[model samples]
Target: MDNVITVRDLRVLDGRKTLVGPVTFELPGGSTTGLCGPSGAGKSTVLRALVDLLPHGLTRDGDVEVQGQAIRYGKGDSALRSTVVLVPQTPVVFGGSILDNALFGLRHLVRASRAEMRDRVEQALREAGLWNEVSGRLDSPAQALSNGQRQRLCLARALALEPAALLLDEPTSALDERSRDTVEESVAALRGNRTVLLVSHDPAQVQRLCDRTVSLEHPETLALSAAAA
Candidate 1:
């Protein structure tokens, strides 16, 4: 299988303080891989580095290749983000109808007519496991959905981009048990069809949703990730 993303000796630094690894790993195409560790291990930070979305005052060193193309640091944030969409732990709902939120950011990345855009959004909604709940009310307010629905909508928004890989940051940690299950169902649905890199502290969730695991430890813990399962 081919790797959608390849990282070598990736690191995140604050001033001279080494925050996160000199870790290396590959995300095989169409595979869901888990990134797990104790708190502050930089699991989320690694995701940011992969797409050049590292926060202000922090810098990264190492090579990141997306489908064999090198991702130059601090360049083309828009393009890189569109290619590998990141859905944060907290769901963000924009001011608009469900349909509008679904099409958010999508309008800039892909070119298509209104009808075509709707078609793509519809497909994404299905892929996110949100179609059955929101299909009839796409015109309704986006904020009206439950928390789980909101997260799935965010997932649909990213899926609409048809990203080469999806970077999910502890997607279910903030939800209630029932909501978590629904989100888990959605992630499970993507197991073999979407290339996903998921970060979660929960070992059981990783076991349930991922094909393999990558372990990240503190700065002193040797900046290399564990072997893929």
Candidate 2:
């Protein structure tokens, strides 16, 4: 597919108040696209809306099509999430061994023998640039990993699902500079192999990692008349 995702006139509403957009964009297959703006522009909210995960009381209006199929608002839940995964800002390591965490989502999504599942986890960890470091300690507690390792582990978790698109919401914002670089390298490696929409507050970082960008204006800057349309 030339485009993996196509969004048009997307807007988030808080009981009729326009909190996000009339925003539009398309993600070409296997390309890294950045979604960027200053704070309050609802960059993260837009990602949530894409997966039908908007918070309670918040609703979205738009046309979001993935792999050429339209996803009606509030309708694309777990199945949609499996196709277009979102990796949030903070790393979330579940309470379990590193191996458990890696296979967490995969176990639910794929039906396979133990050996097959473990192989998939290994492939995912390698893709996340983490297998070399954790290969000998797969059975160790996940909490023992450093912040950067945890973030990569989360990336591996998502990668294991083999989603068509990944929505990364400031994946490195919570990391230290060193950790940020590591995560950036992992992300950069996926440039031509995965379709990604990255939300970032740092333009420099976006320039370094993204093939192209979609900039969001501050919510206040959107014309009310246009939003009402």
Best by TM-score: 1
lDDT of each: 0.87, 0.88
136-179: candidate 2 lDDT, tens digit per residue = 99999999999999999999999988899999999999999999
Off by over 4 Å in 1: 218-229
How many clashing pairs in candidate 1? Answer: 0
Candidate 1 residue 190 C-alpha distance from true site, Å: 0.5
Could you tell me the lDDT of residue 225 within candidate 1? 32
User: For all the candidates, what are their Cα RMSDs to the real structure?
Assistant: 3.4, 5.9
lDDT string for model 1 (54-173, tens) is 889999988889999988866566878789999999999999999999999689877788998899899999999999999999999998999999999999999998899999998988
lDDT for residue 175 in candidate 2, whole number 0-100 = 93
- Top candidate on lDDT is 2
Q: Model 2: number of clashes?
A: 0
